[model samples]
Target: MGRKAKFNEGVIVRKGPGKKAKKTERSNFSKKLDSQHQKHRARKRLQKIKERQDKQKLLSEKKKKLDRIQRKELSKKQTEEESEVESEEDESEEIKILPSKGYSDDNKLWLKPKQKWIVQNENINDDESDDNGEGDSDTEDDHDDVNNEVEDEEEESDDDIEMENGKEELDDEEDSNLKVENLNDLSDDDSDDQDEFDSENEKSDKDVDDLLPIEKQNIKLKKKQAKDQKLADEEMQLNIANQEVFQFPIKESEEEIQSLQDVQQRIREVIAVLTDFKKLRDKTHSRSEYLDILKKDLCTYYSYNEYLMEKFMQLFPHSELLEFLEASEVQRPLTIRTNSLKTRRRDLAQALINRGVNLDPIGKWSKVGLVVYSSQVPMGATPEYLAGHYIIQGASSLLPVMALAPQENERILDMSAAPGGKASHIAAVMKNTGVLFANDINKDRIKAVVGNFHRLGVVNSVITCMDGRKYPDVLKGFDRALLDAPCTGTGVVAKDQSVKTSKDQQDIQRCYNLQRQLLLATIDCVNAKSATGGYIVYSTCSVLPEENEWVIDFALKKRNVKLVDTGLEFGTEGFTSYRQFRFHPTMKLTRRFYPHTHNMDGFFVAKLKKFSNLIPKSADHDEVTEENVENEKK
Candidate 1:
């Protein structure tokens, strides 16, 4: 402000102590220009840096995505390889290893000579022929050729004999000129020959007479009987071939020894012959033959699908797998649990026995459970069953309620209760004094639940058709809860063979998810604290580890629960690990009933105790989020 500005020749200068100073207006303008340039440079630099950062970020994200995809592909490849290895191992284990020897020819039962029975039809007219005879001429020609060849040879021999006799007569006449003796001999010979010819003609006439229509019909009936007999003999041979066990022959030279591949080939050939499945590619084969081939090709011991067989071998040892295969081939014994509320065990046993039902007590663990070894009448239609004195139930289905141990005057909940076997058992155990809520998601199945409950004289049970997973929100404080969750039914394959092919790995995963939901809901519904601690019994009619131990593992993490021993000593311990999955160590306390080991359906039962009343935080958040979304939509 104190210095005045002056300009000269497009330049301005001011006097100062040290040197010429520029004018304030010009200097200020130049400074402003410089500051603007600096700011522009800084903005460009910042923009370049930002662009570099964005490019790097994009590259990083792309690399991360590629890594994820690669990881997934690697894992999938590993899983496939592992599964292949496991299957190979299972096959090597299950298929009986042939010794250094070849298959035995000891009995040669499978090599029985084919027998062809020819039923001679004496009444068949040589002149008669049916219209279809042209098409079947090959078969008929075979018979005609045999008969004509024998008759032609016999006629030629008889002519030669006659020629020889004529020569002998001529020689006798020439040597001895005794006309009377010769004449008498010729007459006798001619008479004898005439008699023989007459007898032959009479027999031929009789045979022709037997060729009438009625006689021909009788001959055809005999042929039919002969054909049936041949078939019966063939069937008997096949049965013997199947029953006779043979061993492989040992060879001194190891180089010529039969390997597993050769043994498998031999087995396949034997099975094909036994089952009459010779032409697998034949389109005209029956369904039964096709099914036999499919079963034989799938496994050496069982008719299970490849996946199921592999899983079974993975789950059990070779000996147990054999037992399981044998057990699955036979029907499970019909078992009944007496309704204690309706009849006592002793009385029901006596009543059933009187009704021609052979009953054997199941075990010392259950007084009311009876294994029906034989029943003359339909056990389900019997008067005792109709009167609710007893209810037909699988031995495995009774384990959950036995583990539950419901008391009188206590509230119990059965989640996913349909066809109410376990629920009825629970009610009977409670002596019909407690309130039992039996719930199912399906309305149609609920009808069955109601029917079974009514038939079993279950008075305290209340049926509801609703999703069991929603029960924790609407109902609470049940003294005990049973979640016999719906599963793939791998356990009851003995009863329902279709289960072998009806389910797959995806179905198991779906069941696993549903079971987890139902289990969590059951935990919430049961009382947390009681005089007698509240219990939740989780059961599944499946032998799959994903549905049993893995589900328990998930519940242990998500819910405030702990597993306890079910006090059942009949079954083996639960699986602690399967494949890549590892379960809690305490899961061993759960019980696994195998059909081969326990003489029951494959079943899994886990008894859990809830010590905390706290609700899961995730559930609350989920509910809140759902409410907010609904409100916003409205």
Candidate 2:
């Protein structure tokens, strides 16, 4: 139907000689396939067999490891149980060592066997080697014997026993093969062990001497050790007690060293001004003969061979100043006291130069003068002073005398004048014609003032060492007076920086009291204007308000003295009081001349006049203006 299906029915059914050939080919092919399948099956069987053998080998190794672990665990448990028993025995032995009625001390003696065991344990680690060069093999044999005994025991499962037997047999075979070698090694090892045991016994016997009797020997040893330790500890404690805590010396840098050297140099220079080598040597030589002159002289004066004058001379032997160091010479410095009334500023300058005393006019107070340091001659010892050319006054100190404006023959009092500086100047203003009563509380200083008066050829002067407060009670009819009170000298710190460090509140309070006392003393000296119409100048070298303006206010409250403005055309106004003038050291023309500014001393001055009328003039009694005051609080 489908194109006759290619007419294959009879062809497909054809069997005959072709059928026999096909059957033979088919049988050959079947044989070939069977051979291939057999080869594959053979390979699978070989692989399975190899895997089984490997698994058996692995199981055998695992079983051996587990057996070894069980044996070790058993041995560890046995050792721990043995340790507990030994510890309990040791405790019992310790309890037995306690003091008994028969024993005088709590000590015990060890039995010989006990002693030997303790000593052996102390000195040696556990010994694993038996008497052997064959020790390892012997241990293996012992293990195998134990395994065989374990196998013989009826307690184990049948399987375990069989495994144990198998292990024992394996070990026995190994032992048999090594028996002859082991016997020889064992014999050698036993001989060595005998020698070792004898040697160990001898060592133990020798060591026992160090541990003879546990009771007495250990107690004495422990006591001795305790004493030694106590002594050592005591010595250590003593050392700690005696040791001084040390501080490192601060190392100064070059600049600091230089600064210290400079300070020392300045100190030496200042000290030199206070001593004369010639006078010292004269006093020494005149006092004694046959004495160690140099050493004794040093010991008597400085107690060290470092007196400023001597040190300077030693350093500068050939210096021109050496002449002044000679015993016969007298070295003195010049002093210039200004005369504002008579000598004009320019005329005074020329007059001083003509007199061969170098003079320089101080600023603002052209009336005040200074002797030039360049001129080596001593102006104090000059003939001009004898002839009343000048009074050796401080440059800043001349401000008050100028501010006071005393007339010719006007009676003036210098309340605190010592060595007669301003008093002599006041006398010069009066042309040595008016009476000037110069008073100082220090009697020792009166001689100095007298000497100054004599040198200056001053005539209208009287020097007294009475308290200034008693001046009104004694004799007081003066046109003017100066109360140069003592102060804390804070303003002078620039000239001497040490003052800056030295000042404190305590010092200021102390100075405050002193200033008040001095002011009171001065107030007592000034006469009411109706009586001599006198005035007073209050002054100090202090910058503190308590010693300056406050002191003035305190004086005014207690006395009839009226504050007077200096009317100085040059310098600035003073503190709060318009009448009083302030000269700050830092300013150009102030009464204070600080080292940083004018290289001069610090000073303060206030001028006042006693009102003659009962009721003071409103203009004269003007309150201080706010602009004149330093608004910042002190």
- In terms of lDDT, which candidate is strongest? 1
Per-residue lDDT of candidate 2, residues 1-634 (tens digit)? 4665666666657457765466544344334445778889999999989977876675576567657766865675456445545544343221111222322211112111111001112222133111111222433443353333222222222223233332232233334322222333435444454445435443322233222244335645776899999999999999988954321112353134334344344334323422544333334233222123322233233222323333223322222223322211222223365554345557666765776656565554454566565554566565555555566665656667776676776777888888777777777777777688889989899888998788667788888898765667787656777877767755444344445335566566666656666676566666665244477777787655556666666556655666766645544334553224543322222232232233344457666677642433443223421211222122
Off by over 4 Å in 1: 1-301, 616-634
Model 1 / residue 312 / CA error / Å: 1.7
TM-score per model over all chains: 0.52, 0.40
The worst-scoring run of ten residues by lDDT in candidate 1 lies at 107-116
Range of the 10 consecutive residues with the lowest summed lDDT in candidate 2: 111-120
Candidate 1 lDDT tens digits, 1-634: 5976655656666757653564445444334355778999999999989977876675566457556655765565456445444444333222111221222222111111111112222332332122113213433342343333223322322322333232222233234421223333445444454355435433232243224344546755776899999999999999987864322223353245346565445444444444443443344545455344434443643446667766775676544665777777777888898888878989998987898888789999887899998988998888888888888888888889889988999999988788888888888878889699999899888888888888888899888888787788899999989999989888888788888877777677677877877888889898888766589999998998888998899888878899998988678888788877788999889999877777788899999999898866777547644653454354
True-vs-predicted CA distance for residue 314, candidate 2, Å: 45
Q: lDDT of model 1 at residue 467?
A: 78
RMSD of 2: 33.9
